[model samples]
Target: MPSIDLQETGLRALNTTLQSVEQKDAAYTITNPMGAHAIACGLTHEINVTIEGHAGFYCAGMNQRANVTVKGHAGVGLAENMMSGTVRVTGNASQSAGATAHGGLLIIEGDASSRCGISMKGIDIVVGGSVGHMSGFMAQAGNLVICGDAGEALGDSIYEAVIYVQGTVESLGADCEEKPMDEEHIKSLTGLLALSGINAKAEAFKRYGSARTLYNFQPDNAGDY
Candidate 1:
């Protein structure tokens, strides 16, 4: 594994190397991130990057086929708009973690702040700790697995996304409601937990999703609109 110190090589040179390289399975270790923003954005190759310390905003934005791990905390919008690849944060994450992501998995070993998966298209996020209010707002399609409690207005106006919470939810959003977890859902949750290396029981989770009542415009329910 090639190791680069961000303090010496700079973030621009690191990202440039990741983007320009055509190697199949390159591995890199980044040290002294010191909460640097946009550390590894727009990578398209199947590589592995390990950040030894805290990272600032958009640590691995728009990543594809790369597996990036942050050993410490992450700033806002971590893994934002990612297309594919895995970004794992060993520590807490700020607001809007995995926002509008289209594919792949994002794992936060610690808590996540507000709007955890806002407008997420097809990403899968596994949070080991609690999430702040308005999580999964306008989510299109994806799975958000929260091992801990959820704050107010969870899944506000969400669409087609599945949210699984092991702890209590303060409140549900406009079109969100608790749903039954069938065998398939249980199996899926189990798989996700295993993949994320979370040691929680799948049966302990409660699923929340759209009520489908707001799929079409209803004049009688215009107050919510």
Candidate 2:
């Protein structure tokens, strides 16, 4: 396990080094990946990469068959358009954590900002903390489970995506509604919480999502508006 000291090298050097590695074969233990941009883009192999600090935009964009773990906070678009494999952030994440993700699992141990899983596709996002407004907006296919509270207008303009919030929500988006907690949901949430290392009881969490009415269009059913 060779360590790539990010302090010694800058973002350009990091990109060059990652690009130069063999596809789906080489592994790296990158230290001080501090705010490096596009750390592992378009990877295609069973590569295991560990980033030991804060990462900037698009840290693992277009990833494929690569397991990348971030030990600290990440900037926007953490795993944009990820094709496969897993990307785990051990700390808090910024906006658009898993934007347009195609497939794979994204785990965030801390809070994630707005639009956590925007326009997602077949990607499973698990956030251990709260998420800002408009999370899961325009999400196509996948599951977003937030073990903490969710901000305003969650799951707006969603599509085939399921967002399970265990805490309070400021407001539900168009077509979004609170549903009855069933045994299946509880089972799924239990496993998910355990995987994310969250000790909270699954039964204590409440579920909310689109009512399937606002999926196609937004309707003003409320008189308050």
Candidate 3:
């Protein structure tokens, strides 16, 4: 495990160290990484980068196969548009976290603000806390697992995305619906939780997703939407 103190190191030094990292057994630990933007962006190597503190926007943007973990809260778009691998935030996340993520596993152990997982393509988001309104809006394809409460207008205008809510949903979106929990969903939820190191009973959760009513433009329902 290679430890790099971000306090005594520049962002370039930290990033350079991470970029040159090729050892899978190495844990490039960065301590006191406060609000460092693009800390590990465009990393194609398979490595584990752990930050002991907070990070700024696009912290792990465009990542290919690196796993990044933040032990503290993260700013907006924490893993914006990540390609592959995993990004885990142990604390709360700001707005638009994992926005437009194409592929990856984004695990938020705390509450997330609005537009979380907005416009996601194939990323999977598992949150242990609540999420703000309008989540999964215009989502193309993905899975959003919220173990806590959800704000108003959840899953608005969603498309081909599966949403699992364990708490109260203030309101369902334009064409979303609450569906019955089945064995398959329970297995899926269990897998997602286990992936994020969360322990919960899937039967205690509820599922919500697009009703396929607004998949295409509709005349009667499209007025308000």
Candidate 4:
């Protein structure tokens, strides 16, 4: 395992070092992040990275096969557009967490701010706490599991994505509606909960998804247009 101190080496150099490493299953510890942005973006190898402090925007954007863990809070767009692997935030996360992600898993142990999982594409997000408004907006494909309450307009204009919420939702967004949780959904939720280490009953969650009402042009629904 190697350690990189952000105070001694700048973020650019640290990321460059991580990018340059060709060893398989390497591990790194980053110290003194001090809320720096883009700490470990674009890592293509299978490695383990642990950040000791808070991180700024896009901490692990576009990551591939790297297990990145943030010991503290994260700024906006944490794990944005990640292709594979896992990014875990032990603390709270700012807005747009996991936005536009294509694959992999994003686990947030604490609360997430507005627009969490917005435009998500084929990614899986598990949030241990509440998420603010407009979450899953325009989501194309993926799953968003929220263990706590959801703010206003949850899943606005979402498409083909599945959302599981354990607590109350303040409101539902356009073309989004609560669906019955069948046996398959329960099994899936159970697996996701176990995978993310979230201690919640699968039966307690309610599913939400697109109603497919807006998938095509409806002449009778001209009032919405």
Give the candidate order by descending TM-score.
4, 1, 3, 2
Model 1, 31-56: lDDT tens digits are 99999999989999999999999999
- The CA lDDT at 101 in model 3 is 88
Note the clash tally of each candidate.
0, 3, 0, 0
Q: What lDDT score goes with residue 123 in model 1? A: 97
Off by over 4 Å in 1: 222-225
The Cα local distance difference test for each model comes to 0.95, 0.83, 0.86, 0.95
Q: How accurate is candidate 4 locally (lDDT)?
A: 0.95
lDDT of 4 by residue, 84-175 (tens): 99999999999999999999999999999999999999999999999999999999998999999999999999999999999999999999
Query: Which residue runs does candidate 3 get wrong by more than 4 Å?
Result: 219-225
Better of 1 and 3 by lDDT: 1
Clashes of 4: 0
- Please provide TM-scores, in order, for all candidate models, with all chains considered together: 0.97, 0.86, 0.92, 0.98
Clashing pairs in 1: none
The lowest-lDDT stretch of 10 consecutive residues in candidate 3 is: 214-223
